[model samples]
Target: MYKNIKVIAFDADDTLWVNETYFREAEHQFAKLLAKYETENKIDQELFRKEIENLAYYGYGVKGFILSMIECALELSNYKINPKTIEAILNIGKKMLNEPIELLDGIEEVLSSLQDRFKLIVATKGDLLDQERKLEKSNLLNYFHHIEVMSDKKEKDYKKLIKHLDIHPSEFLMIGNSLKSDVLPLIEIGASAIHIPFHTTWAHEEISEEASNNFKYHTVANIKDVLRLF
Candidate 1:
């Protein structure tokens, strides 16, 4: 099925290494810090809304998330949020930023096997500086031919990337965890996509069952399974 595929683009966050997990932990801490003001469920919902609202202004990444968190805290607290809590929130973001980049199991093995046979690229959305830091620390940078830190993962974005890579849609394949950012967009652009779900997913990345079945793409249990496809 992949005989025509020459370029394989990977999503760098939860797909290649630990990312969403840290965000989840941060969210938990954020919720706890605001527990006195609102219920955990309400705090979670509001934070999500704030994050989406801030997407245009901040784009995607931990930095944006941290800012949204602060906004949510202020709104939930009716602008009377304590300064110490704000400091704690900032510390949470700091700890997340400094977290080690632990590569997913079998990621290195699969990359090692495929790098010689195909053009590998990292196609992900995040703060450019943070993404670069993680990639450098990951020790997997040498395997990719190119790296793309996208501001948004949409059909237009993938189309531009495909053009820049000089590959046709049919010649490119994307593998990632998010159906929203990674799989659906590539499929919409006439490219092949493989969905390898991470154990944790951001709420925005979740898709309806009907939508998942509507797309014609491959699904794998893990990154290692990608080896069988190629």
Candidate 2:
């Protein structure tokens, strides 16, 4: 299946190290901070809405998420949120940025095994500085030929990356956790993709089953499982 795939791209966040888990933790903390203003359920829903709405302006990553939390807190509080509470919300983002990189089991093994055979790169969407910091901390940087911190993961974005690599879509393969960002777009562009779902996913990244059933891609239960496909 991979015979024509010369360039293999992997998502950076949940696929390489623990990411969505931290976002979940931050969301829980955000809900607690605004408990008096609104119910947890309401806060959670509104924050998600705010994040999606802000994506165009802030793009993705911890910074955008922090702004969304603050916006949600302000609206839920009727613009009466405490300054210290705002400070605490920022701290949530800081903590996430500082969290230790917990590499998923079998990531290195897969990278190591594939590095010798394929041109590997990190095809992900997030703040460039934060993504670079994580890669540096991951100690997995050397294994990859390039790191692509994308603004968004759409069909055009993947097409641009493929064009930059001077490779055909058929020779490009993507592996990541989010089907919306990683799998479906590649399929649409005539590229191969493997879906390795993380236990957690952002609401924006989730897709309907019917939306994905039409696409042809391999969904593996674990990262190591991808090796067998090669």
Local distance difference test values of all predictions, in order: 0.94, 0.94
lDDT for predicted candidate 1 compared with the true structure: 0.94
lDDT of 1 at 217: 89
lDDT of 1 by residue, 1-230 (tens): 68899999999998899899999899999999999999999999999999999999999999999999999999999999999999999999999999999999999999999999999999999899999999999999999999999999999999999999998999999999999989998888889999999998999889898887878988899899999876
Q: What is the alpha-carbon RMSD of candidate 1 to the true structure?
A: 0.8
RMSD for each of the candidates = 0.8, 0.7
Per-candidate TM-scores read 0.98, 0.99
lDDT of 1 at 178: 92
Off by over 4 Å in 1: none
List the candidate 2 regions with Cα displacement exceeding 4 Å.
none
Worst 10 residues of 2 by lDDT: 34-43
